[model samples]
Target: MSGTSSQGEGSPGGASADSVRRRRVPRAERERQIVDVAVEVFAKRGYHATSVDEIAELAGISKPMVYLYLDSKEGLFLACLHREANRLVVAFQGAAKAVAPSPELRLHAGLLAFFGFVAEHRAGWVVLHRQAAELTEAIAGAAAEARRAVMAEVADLVRAGIAESGPASRLSAEDADFVAHALVGAADSLTDWMARHPGRTPEDVTLRLMNMVWVGMGGVLAGRTWSLEDPGDAPH
Candidate 1:
């Protein structure tokens, strides 16, 4: 009788564990899982080459379910772009805010965070950097919006730096915007360079950029002007 009771108890315990394993995941979680898989697929294959069927197989769901969650292939790609862009912005803002209010330090922290994101989330970065363009108007617009968001943040930092330099500083809001655009453009180009030179770290890149841009800006604020005639007067 004791043997039979022990067998009966073990059967129910096994059944209960199976039930827990088969429990339905929440809808939001399931959608996230799909998007996560889609990011990898899109990164590897690009938007045109990636297929919904493959994403579903990788995610362990039906293609219909992927459509049900994201509506269409375009929708899934858009979702990936939006999530990655927001994550990048959050990383930059969080890192910048954590440090002292000095604009130089803040910018360095933000650039380090940006490079770190690119290094760590290579797939997501590929989606944002390479795949976003050459798509539909909506897709291109989304990418542009993300760029504008980053540019705005950089502009604000540049503006603060200008203000801190006091009345003698020749830089205005317009100048700040220009500087921001230049910085963003340089960072974008440098990402490709970073990929080639894998040994160089994010810190190394950030320091190089700070020395290039910020140090020059300091000379400009100090009433030191650069001219073609006196090219030698430029900051080293």
Candidate 2:
């Protein structure tokens, strides 16, 4: 009895000896952890001020391991940018699909998804929008590419809206592009506001944006115009 292992070389709790061994993280999982920590540190300290050592420490991995896994500091930052950017794009795409009947509804859904993503992933959002600008040329380019991709999605939504409304919408191709750019710019700016106002829900943000966008589009379609020269021609 003394020589034999009653618990199969494990503790009396019945876990096998092998089960008690240190858990090994898969390569992909570890890489994700590194990017996540990098995002947090980079967002808090800005890209130039953030150090690999700090990220490695927060990730519970060695500095050398981080370099080995991510290649270099720039590489790690790029990885974070790519991952977070793709996440937002996918979130918007899925929301667009979820509300397919109306172009305006799809846009509302997309905005809701966008705000929710930013609220849930504040660190990732900050890294993509704020810290990405502080990085080197190559890294900044990667982040900019991501923004362009999201803008393209918005543009597609605008195209859909114009098509659905036919000639009544009165939005030309050029006009749609311009509106898309404006919407994307407004959303980007509002995201910063959402970050500062954590108490605001994604639904609330989406509704406010929808009001501004749809009302303006409605006015444009209805041939309504406003001018400073006409004192009574101001927008309500």
Instruction: Please report, as a residue range, the 10-residue window in candidate 2 with the lowest summed lDDT.
Output: 2-11
Query: In order, what lDDT does every prediction score?
Result: 0.88, 0.83
Name the runs in model 1 displaced over 4 angstroms. Answer: 1-22
Reference-based TM-score of each model: 0.89, 0.85
**Among all windows of ten consecutive residues in candidate 1, which has the lowest summed lDDT?**
2-11
True-vs-predicted CA distance for residue 51, candidate 1, Å: 0.5
The sequence of per-residue lDDT tens digits that candidate 2 reaches over residues 130-221 is: 87876689987998899899988899988887787656666788988899899989999999788688888999999999899977886776
Model 1, range 1-236, lDDT digits (tens) per residue? 43332332223444554454455466788889988999999999999999999998888766777887799999999999999999999999999999998999999999999999999998999999998988999999999999899999999999999899887888889999999999999999899999999999999999999999999999887667788998998765
Clashing pairs in 2: none
How well does model 1 score by local distance difference test? 0.88
Report how far off residue 211 is in candidate 2 (Å).
0.4
